[model samples]
Target chain A: MSTVLQSLSTELADAVESAGRAVVAIHARRRIPASGVHWQPGVVVATNHTINRDENITLTLPDGTTAPASLAGRDPSTDLAVLKLAGQSLPVASLRRDAPPKIGELVIALGRPGPGLTASWGVVSRADGPWRTWQGAEIDSLLRLDLAIYDGFSGGPLIDAAGRVLGINTSALARGVPVTIPIATVERIVTELLERGNIRRAYLGIGTQPVRVPESLARKLELKSDLALLIVSLESGGPADRDGLLLGDVLLELDGTAVNDASDVLAKLGGDRVGKPLAARLIRGGQVKALQLTPGERPTSRAA
Target chain B: MTASMTAGLAQEVAAAVDQLRQITVQVRTHRAATGAGILWNGGEPEGPGLVITNAHVVEGERATVELSDGTAARARLVARDLRRDLAALEFEPGRAVVGAVVRDSPPLRVGELVIALGHPGGLTGAATLGIIHRAESDREGRTPRWIRADVRLAPGFSGGPLADATGRLVGVNTMMQGGLALAIPAVAVEAWVRRSQTMAVS
Candidate 1:
């Protein structure tokens, strides 16, 4: 007798069979290989953290053939890396971009750690709006899963019951919690990485920590917000240092927006903001001083 | 979807678990650790009931088998292959026994729903649901060494039954590796039982 349970099982297996064709084993690191998806024609996407070395990368296709793949670029902020595969006929992942995954929706994670394709199933646990990573990259959406993660899971794809790609899975982001980098974000990064060979981010090169201004100081300075960021460290000869900003300055606003936290400063430091001058308001020598600081393009491997 | 559809799926799963529980038995040796076993037919239409468990779970020549109805029986070790980590126990069938129905053909597919019945943490007849992590290779006449699954299995779950969605036995839950449950495929177990029974008759 046909039952709903059997149908569910068969459909799930069919989904895996279809989606798994795009999943390939990436042999970039030592020991067990990681996973990568055939995102587009001649383009593969994987996790940045899993690619230990920049060169000498190879891939195991679904047909058990080994092919050399060149690393196009990597963005540590988003934990994503794009690789260029030449003359390969692998199928591209079918992406679901019209709608975001809902909470409690059944999802499967597919990985090709070895020649065999592995799968794990679970429900989407949490789905929220865009969030920023510690590296300052803003993910399109926060997709937390309730599934068990395994080896090579970092660079795999989180697929739905229909076998359509939802996002790229990564354990490096969110402090070891499995998070999916949505299709929108992946598409944006893949395009930029393929073009520029790296992600361009704006940086002030100054470290700040949130601090509470004393009520007496706040009243004297006529400050609008009681909380301000205290400049703790400055990169020598960096943008902030070159802009005449001191180490002990209390930053109150940037571009007329209140700067209460470090992320607030990051919110204004996108790639488009790199060569533009920003208005900064800070309390220097116990006096409100205004300065125009132009952010610089953050060099690769440098933290703000 | 109506409430009845959801309930129908739930009922189907519950019924599959019920069928699996009847074929599952608790295996206890002189050791402190307890494991589970599956009742087998011993290749005879009406012969003494046979229990299949892990060789690691049954160390001595004799171990105690407890049926689903809480009836205990003394069983003698009939066949053991340490390399395969499988052992067969023969016990008198004081009453009718339900043997596991093994799936014969059309090997497992990746992502198919599977159910595992075990006695984890001293809990009897506990069931956990998962999907087949990877299907066996399609090579003819060759069975994969282990059937890896995504199910969570504890120490007490060894020698239990890993059934498909329809409750047909697929593998014997043996050990866990890399957080994935590895099972001995039932087809291999059936072959071993046949060969072992032949050696006993010879």
Candidate 2:
């Protein structure tokens, strides 16, 4: 038992030592952080390729070694990609668990900002499933970190004391605090990427608008909740349209679950709904109607 | 025409410029200032006047006219096509006004003499002389005729008439090339003015 403990201690120390030295700084040109609010401390996260990959890209490694890295793959819809690097024994950061972290827990970040390895320490500011970034993009799993995040800290790793990656440092707070992607979400994304090349999302191809029913209108309509989803536009030949969903219809529920917000419908439509028949309830002209819809394959907008 | 014929041609050109003074209106826009000349009346020279200008001169404004002699008149923007960057304006009932004689065709050839007339930089009457450098059949596939010249037309000279050596209106001075000169063919601009008039009448 004493021998095993000694061996484990030595291995852990070696792993830390190797990882600290192996984490290299990456820099690509014309790939700038979107806004200040999403800035993360100590590390700069950057897109390895330009928003449009046709432009030239420059990647710099730690120790001032710069080279060109080919654009691995990017999903236009998701705006995520894997940039291929040529080096060996790259220090891979471990992902955090999918569960939300307890509030007030300490979080740290390690990033290759500019020319050196930078570290930022903060606490888990907020753990919300959905919060919008400064650019009007809704971050699905947002873990706000309490740190003054500057530019060049994007695409860096937000980690914990155990060296587990809590999330990918994405942006800064509107008031200049840093924000990150929750580890649980990143882990699921990694799993999905390993099994499938991209984030496999299910779509119904229907535009929805939030209906904030007035108190009098809700009483007059005799609704359970004041919230309703007004179907705005239905894509031609989409599953929703084929299932008899029409414009001006107000959606009530999906698969026996009431939907009070647009995110609720989206959350239910995540990977599980792929090729699955769903029960959608709608109120058209104050008459409730249910339709059976089997989701179709999401439109592929990529070369591969 | 020969210089002997043009001996009176300059006087006639000055007279034409004098007649155009009634229709030569000052247009003030948010970003720039320009002048436009109206060909009052129809082919018979006895109908409501029509304002002619480079389309860029009067963009995005409710039509209103200001005469060079300083009388403001209410006008209506008739038609605008960006391809040619030319626009027309229609006005209410007005008295007899002078109109130019359109050249039967584009300029004869490169080095053919031409005179540009307008208010360069808002100066009342400015004229520059230069020979046509190149006569192209088409510009961006819209107007199939354009003349590139060395005569300089300043910012305020757009929509001013470009007359041949014989003093016949041949083009509507449009843009300057590196402080040089360029004009849209008068026949094409007249066609737009005519088409716009027909639409306004109907």
Per-candidate alpha-carbon RMSD to the true structure: 1.7, 25.1
lDDT of 2 by residue, A58-122 (tens): 44454446544444344433234444445433345555565556566655554554443444445
Model 1, residue A258: distance off in Å is 1.3
Q: State candidate 2's TM-score.
A: 0.46
In terms of lDDT, the poorest run of 10 residues in model 1 chain B is B40-49
lDDT by candidate, in order shown: 0.92, 0.57
State candidate 1's DockQ: 0.71
- Report the error of model 1 at residue A155, Å: 1.4
lDDT of 2 at A148: 39
Identify the leading candidate in terms of DockQ. Answer: 1
- Return the lDDT, model 2, position A90: 38
What TM-score would candidate 1 get against the native?
0.97
Could you tell me how far off, in angstroms, the CA of residue B51 lies in candidate 1 after the best superposition? 0.3
* Candidate 1 residue-wise lDDT, A238-287, digit = tens: 99999999999999999999999999999999999998999999998988
